[model samples]
Target: MQTVCRDAPGCPEPGPGYPDLGAVPLVALNVSVRRRLGLYLNPRAAVAADWAALAEALGYEYLEIRALEAQPDPSARLLDDWQGRGGATVGRLLELLRDLGRHDILAELRGRIEEDCKKYLQRQEQPVQVPAVDSSVVRTLEMSGITTRDDPYGNVPELFDAFICYCQKDLHFVQDMIKELEQTTFKLKLCVFDRDVLPGSCVWSITSELIERRCRKMVVVISDDYLQSNECDFQTKFALSLSPGARQKRLIPVKCKAMKNEFPSILRFITICDYTNPCTQKWFWIRLAKALLVP
Candidate 1:
């Protein structure tokens, strides 16, 4: 897994008088905290005057103000500033935390920030899993290093034909689907999270770019776990935003374990590929392959 510090570049390092958070696990600084901070900061609502007031009131240094201003999005810039703190950053952050009456959250954030700094200093290499592609055609394409430049359709060049959006709980089933798809006559290039995301790259950036702009299709593994996951929700919404209405067909929802009612209001109406049915499993993949335009 990519270290949290890399994802939040310039994260503050622990200085004198702060609680030592060296022992905190890297996983403890997960997406939830980032999401929470994003919601809390509401960067879009912060005006120029508010920033100037904050800087003057907090005595923020040039580096801090510059860092905060660099991010185009409010939430992202907030995260960057939060992570990018050092001695000065920590002091300012602490004051803000105290004013907000979020000491408990600050304590948790302190641990995560310290842990991230340590990981960045260590230059750790995140372990990456090689993607498992079942289709012989895709395997051959991978070996041959074929790319979207070779596409006969003259569409926007894509690194992969499809990006698979699924929860960790559905990995086994997804792997099985990949294997079955491999046997199909058509070549399917898929971007599975565990396998495709390069080590050290920001997970959110890579996922967003691929799912929303780069990939030709998005295959969502629909399940209870998927619906509940914040990251999955983001991926689904981002994909849906790009392809709405009948164009929503670009988003292929595979029913792995979710009930009809469990699906979000927007997704309930779409024709889902029900992989949950044993009798129709074969037919489902075949139909899915056809929908994906498998040769």
Candidate 2:
């Protein structure tokens, strides 16, 4: 265990005012208002391998998902439009990093190592060898004799490979569909109505945040009820606004039942996946898996 300077998030040597954050539980740290001042919750753990510690040091709020949580239906979260939606699997995030140059990444690793060491001290853990800023060599570091050299964000591992948003009324069918897809090992991060919302989080605010910042792509489970609900309108509108490319590319409309097209003007160009066909569920999952895996 040793005291070290991470200095990320523009904080001083120990990382802002709460120097002991390295010792705090990540879950608790996430809810602490003081720690969220400068940090953005990194859903992709590229910047810090041990995002738990990074959150403590930088005051990042929100759960940083390295891999999606375990689930029964994997396809529930798999994005169907990866190429058009600007999403790459964990494998792609790795390729992107490697393409940026290994030495440069190693330099970043060195800084992250230092930060991890400080955080480890709070856990009564051993310190590992971390490189200095000028050091060019990438040494394998071990705590308790275990090496830590893997990229945290670059790998496709989890159930429900993507996050899906829909009205609660459709959960019965959605869950069944997701279950079928999970047989193919697609994991999803679909939002469960009441279980997912924490007490402190504003429901509307959280919904907007998830649609805008969390989901790689947004799917609207289209039905007559969905189109008529105010809540549904809010979510679909938010999804349309956060889309990265042309509206047609990102907003996916899944027609589960008979429904009228009530999309806003911005979402007019979006593509619709009418699951009305007998094979729509299977075909959509296959397409989605390919999209998430290939690019």
Candidate 3:
């Protein structure tokens, strides 16, 4: 029946003689009611501006308008300019708030904004779908060993000692691993998807052949993202096919995250090097180098 300021320090109640607003939600309040009742709100223009800035910093611009709406004297021009920007985030928040019918506490709103942003980013970060290698193509590569024949470095029978199979999202971790391996005394040649594949070459052609024939061992960087990727799935299957009897020797699993429960059924039996643990990093490199049989 009465308007309450949820954002301010004291949760200030509306003054005497002010209209009751009759449980109408702030979002649905008409411009006339807002113009009359807005003065009683605790967060003045300055505080509202600070809230807007905080929301923008958290990557939720939608909260900016809602923040301004809490102010006693919000700038109409500023609200118009914010709406003009027209981001998906703003639209999403507006819809969510409208459906809820009331504003939440500022802290609760901040948490919600962060969670929504993270989910949105995760959706956008989905791995690029790499076309699956045809069964006929797999058989052809296996029978002819065309990967070796097509190799630019013909004389060197072993094109790469180890192939680093990973999701593109984990590239930063993979790059760091490559850098560390390079710095080591071991004479190990690593094959990475981005660096090893020749420019203008079809991605599937390079990846499939390299996993099937060229690389002696495949170091699969396991994570939730990796499990969901078609490319990683294809590469892992090919690597597993190469080592029928002894998979551990040919296919090494490196745990970039705790993925034992989510790992593929075929690979579950094998021991995984837990690189996710900071204390085990040195040991992880040693174990992986040994697995690759680095000289």
Candidate 4:
């Protein structure tokens, strides 16, 4: 939060007239929004030593995580703590939330905070410089199925660094994947089904097109939930079909956790990255990012 000024789509702070968003108080946010934010951070309880995704996303050090997750308002405490350390702002919080792939929450937080700022400015008779809602945020939420879709794919080609296929059960892990690959130095664009795919399209058709034409590589998150998903089966097999014998190095199977069942026989020919193994953890993101680099 005190690190960068990287503002994101959705979060509008320093208001139409207010400047210096780098230190907006948490009190500027609505109570309901603060409570909603706790829904994501409190229960996660990421301690400093774990190198947990939440900790990474928020850039928290030491066991300071518990101090941020304090009750009544964990999100508020987190923001206050970051601000107290200097350089905390609404824009920085938005950027961190984006890294966590919680743009849905970002949109809500942004709107409420803006509304509060607007009211305060109006009472002061301050000139309001209300810019239009960020179109990119709108378009993003639309494509992610959080808002109305006005032909999401028509304006842009679907080409991407990789398409991530995972069960909802593994969304947190996938979010971590996003934080590392898309947010960090890798800067890889990941087409997550839930976040990037347009809603209401025929799932099978869209999935097939993305696997075959849109993405350069396929990342299949393998776990019990994924194994039970019929849709994952189709996407997995379809990717394999396009790159038979693993000739293209196109399909990257990431085994994140232990499971009762054996790894799928078909994927046996290809080597899998074991994320649960401590030895490989150091090189996991590096290996995955390298595999995703376009040939």
Best by TM-score: 4
The collision pairs in model 4 are none
C-alpha lDDT score of every prediction, in listed order: 0.56, 0.41, 0.54, 0.64
For model 4, what is the alpha-carbon lDDT of residue 129? 37
The C-alpha stretches of model 3 lying farther than 4 A from their native spots are: 1-158, 245-248, 259-261
Clashing pairs in 3: none
Off by over 4 Å in 1: 1-158, 258-261
lDDT of 4 at 26: 32
Q: What would the TM-scores of all predictions be?
A: 0.46, 0.40, 0.46, 0.49
Candidate number with the higher TM-score (2 or 4) = 4
> Candidate 1's residue-wise lDDT over 170-279, tens digit each?
89988987787764565676777786554554555556667765677888888777757867766775566465543546888888874643454345446788987888
Query: What's the TM for model 4?
Result: 0.49
lDDT of 4 by residue, 116-165 (tens): 54443332232233368565654433333311332443455557889898
Provide the lDDT at 78 for model 4: 59
Q: Report the Cα lDDT for residue 80, model 2.
A: 18
TM-score preference between candidates 1 and 4, better one: 4
Give the better candidate number (1 or 2) by lDDT.
Answer: 1
Between 3 and 4, whose TM-score is larger? Answer: 4
